[model samples]
Target: MKRDYDIIVAGGGLAGLIVASSAAYYSNQSMKILVIDRNAIPQQGKKTVSGWVCGDAVGKNTVDYMADRIKISWGYPEIEHPVKGVIAYSPDHETGISFDGEGYILNRQLLPQRQLRDATKAGIEIKERVALRSLMVEGNSVIGVEGDDLDDKTAFKKTAQLVVDCTGVTSVLRTNLPIKSFIQRRIDRDDLEATGRYIYNFELAHEDKTYFDSDYCIIHLDQKLAPGGYGWVFPKGENKVNIGLGVQQKAFDTRNRVMGVHPDLKTLIDEYVEVNPVIKSPRLADGAGDEGNAWGTWQVSVRRQNDCLVANGYMLVGDSAWMPKPLDAGGIGPAIIAATIAGKDAVEALQAGDTSEKGLWKYNKHFINDYGYKTAGLEVFRRMLQGLTNEQINYGMKHFLSKMDIDKITKGEHPEFSTVDRLGMIIRGAMNKKLAEDLKYCATINKVLVDHYHNFPETPEEFSEWHKTLTGHLEEAFALYK
Candidate 1:
């Protein structure tokens, strides 16, 4: 069979560009690859009309992993500001836990330019303003993509040996795929979060590490402020920050009913920015690096990645696969990891002359074992945390979390609950017995989920039974959280 390209990447975003570059690198720049994006050339990978909507913070370790593997590194204006780590504060703002290791708050607008440069330099062709609407399927395989070129109303279609979907959380290609596979076509509303943010350059009203810290990314866990989600103050520079919040719709509605207020995401975000004591006279930083990306909102997935990542000639990467960290709604890290591995696996499958479900299965197993193992556990923990009150969160963070638990969280691993830890919580008295019990339950469930993911099926044939058990575990956890 003849194909227009060896690989057709359905997006030109952060994930798509990186994956294309990786494939080019691993294939010795010999593969015929094409990257298509809905945005124009200047805004090649712009995520939305408002801007490149994202938290734009990623751990240095993940970045290093890609650099080492694909020889593509980011610096200067693209890297933006360096953060020592992430510190997650309790709702009361009285306690803080080091959540993640060293990382950087990226210049979302500028980073795409760097990514585009890398993709082009790698010999990958890019088609801007091309909206990929659906996969072109033949038999059980995805052969290419078809959509409209925004420049005109003309239809566009292209064929490839393999199609990689890196489109955003609401990707039409993934949702409208014309094939039957475990790659979940639709994400549940409950699993999606409405998020918005502002890039602000503010004056320091006071030296308050709790509210603003240039050395560390700050996360505020407050149910009243961000129901079923959290607010973040990620530094972009000494005087600038990317401030935002995310909320689950059902939880947001419940919160509104309880407070007798009808506030939308914009209202809550504006109110959140206004209440910050340390950021005085904050203004949207619309200068050089902030152009067309100073403010925006987007949907994020707060669940584990799709149960199946590949089927026949099709594969899912980044947000299309729901690859964000469930606990914090951070997609960059997982996206990097997934994109890197997907590219390598895709190349190997191509070389072996087999792009079928069975041949491309290694991508699934490799990703799950390497990074996806922890996400399901984090999802379970996030569900439990969303159900807690402000007081419960404060109490739990103060008493329930031990140094070991914090370390586990910092390393992106699920914290295990020992009998001694549960007993210690019990000894803390009946003052907050339910909260302690809930924490213990979540910890236990997390361990179970992590262990299951660690043993993810090595072949597609075993996925049914494996997924059945996973579903059972999640159902049990969901019932308990409810």
Candidate 2:
């Protein structure tokens, strides 16, 4: 006997759970959906994510849709100051300001389980401790998922007409499949960072009405002293915090051109905190994960062999889709927003009885059209910013800091960055400095990237043309600095 589901969602994380619950709720009557997760139910209470960048992982829409049974705990007190801007430290202790556009810092783990419970209520079945060992494919189209039941050491296969890979960067299932996607890149020591965070006694100075506060996501450069990327202290409420480091793997990799070696993140941080007393640090034992770092670690950049992210009867969402913002490696917001839309699109595709390769590819189009522009554009921006020194940073900050106009919006309640100001600042900064002049070339290339992703032209021919054009643009852009 063969058991078939309308949809099979693999890896029950934020994106997976969100889409699964959505399918169950909105289009579930005819949809027999199965979710295979390494863990059972929600990770809300038992799970601990110590050093996530976004304090609020769940956006407004996600929270409103979250199930009541799922409990959410903030890393900090419910009320505190909403940090309006950021202060950067130079190698010689030079300081500069960057707007902290109005955003919430949250415990972040609360919304995933909430989404799961809501999804379960919509009729999605959960097979706990089911590790996806491989994929079940018929010729080119994905037919189902294959996995090992870790609890019983038995292999079980669940067949579905359509398979959605919501797995994170590891993308165990998507990787096993034959889909080609542009999202292929390996992290080098510089492209990667040893991210370590701790929770300790803290205080809050920023707060506002309606009980929302802002916390700073601090950054510092000085490769020798600071590592490849910047250091961030994301405030959770006030006392609780999620502080860690994010680096560009290429910085480390190109420097050493080797893998398996990154800055000793935790130990390095331990040393930094000992010298800097303001950063009340958390102990290593408080960290999450079973890795050698022992406290916390997250990888960046992984995709299937090619940019073939979409195929007949399949679509990848979230980290599985390489949906992260390449600039700072931010995936939470894009994941939720993209997955929310993908869930809606998948349901529509299933109902149309056209779950063909082309049918599912609509999700890709919608995702790229929606958030890909911002993410890909930021990647170029991040690369340029990371290459500059303290003097360059100060120049850029002075010229472009106010371009975000964070204070103007949300009535001082939600300080946020404005796109116009940002662009102007970049333009102004590049016009004056020699290095900036060189980086300007990539600016057009990034715009081309922006154009390709933002436009998301329909039809394979059009997509192909734009994609090729974008590639050429990236080469041109990166070539300027190189």
Candidate 3:
């Protein structure tokens, strides 16, 4: 059957733009591609009416990866400000572990404008103000998508050989897929976080690095303040910062019950900002690039990517697949890597004339090896961290992290503490037995999950057994956290 387009990219966000550009580059501009977005031209990929609601930070290496392969890069106003690293602090503010190298605090609202230009330059057609509703399925394989054109109340439907879903976390297309496939249709409420942030330009109240550090992104781990999540102060300029926090629902309720206070995300965020000792006389910085993006709240998936990312003529990218890192809930880096790989894989699969699950399985294997492999382990670690009390967290961060573990963390990898000497473990365990035991258990399970992911099925045939094994490992980890 002749399709409407070679590829139809749903959601013209960061991931969708990159996927379209990469596909066009790899295909030598020979294939026809279209990007459908819900927002108008100037607001191409604006996430919501609140504007690109995100933490607005990404690692430098992630951008470098895209530049090296796709030859696309960002600079100036879009890149915003560069930071030395990310420093995560303990609840008591006594211990801080830097978890990453150089990165950038982006202007989320402006980045998409640049992305739209790049996509257009790469020969990809774009249709704005179109809200995608669902995948168009024929038999068991996806053939296209159907939705509404927000301009008028007109019904819009389009067919394509392949459809790339880049819709955000609560994607209607993802949840309503008509195919019987391995891709998980819905994310659990427990695994989702209610995150909110504000872009503020403030006078410096003090020079305390713990509260606000211009050179680094500061993350504060206080269960009473954030509840199973964390608060962040990421600098966008010398005196401007993106400040926010995320909270897991169950933990949020528990904290509310214990404290006898009913506070929503906005209330929690206001309290977080008010508690900061370094930000003084803060005002919303919504003038230039942050117009509608000054303050907003959104949900993020603190879990691994979907077990399977592709099915026949359809592929999932970015938040639609829950590609955010479980440890810190950072989504940009993984989305960049996954979208780049998906574009090339999609091109190859299309050229091969087979869009079956077996044919497109390359996306799954390649992404797993490149970045998805370590996520499950991180998810396990995140769960363990969420289950800890403020005291346990403070003690663990102070005593558990060693030089080697710090190095691993700085490289954006999980710290494997299983190799610590038995004597040292015994001594540390003696000091804080419960914390040490829990950390050891998390490390052991993390290692197991990473090794299992290393052997991810080469094709769809072995996926059942492989997924079953993964499910068992994760179940044990989840039970421990509970």
Q: For residues 1-482, could you state the per-residue lDDT of candidate 2 as single tens digits? A: 25478888887776787777666656744588887777655442222243332323223333333332122222233222345444455554555445444444444344455556566667778777777877787776677888788878998888887888876666677656654433343322333343455544444334421111234545455554444566655555455555555555556454343434454556555555454445443443232221222245566542111233567778777766666555445566676666677667788888887777677666767666555555554555556666666566655544433433334211111112233334654455443455545344444555556556666656544567766776676566555443
**Model 3: lDDT to the true structure:** 0.90
lDDT of 1 by residue, 121-155 (tens): 88999998887788898998999999999898899
Best by lDDT: 3
Q: Write the per-residue lDDT of candidate 3 for residues 365-391, one digit (tens) a residue.
A: 899998999899889889988888898
Model 2 misplaced stretches (Cα beyond 4 Å): 1-3, 28-30, 42-101, 179-194, 202-214, 253-263, 280-294, 302-308, 402-432
RMSD of 3: 1.5
TM-score of each: 0.97, 0.77, 0.97
Q: Which pairs, if any, clash in model 3?
A: none
TM-score of 2: 0.77
lDDT of each: 0.89, 0.55, 0.90
Span of ten consecutive residues with least summed lDDT in model 3: 418-427
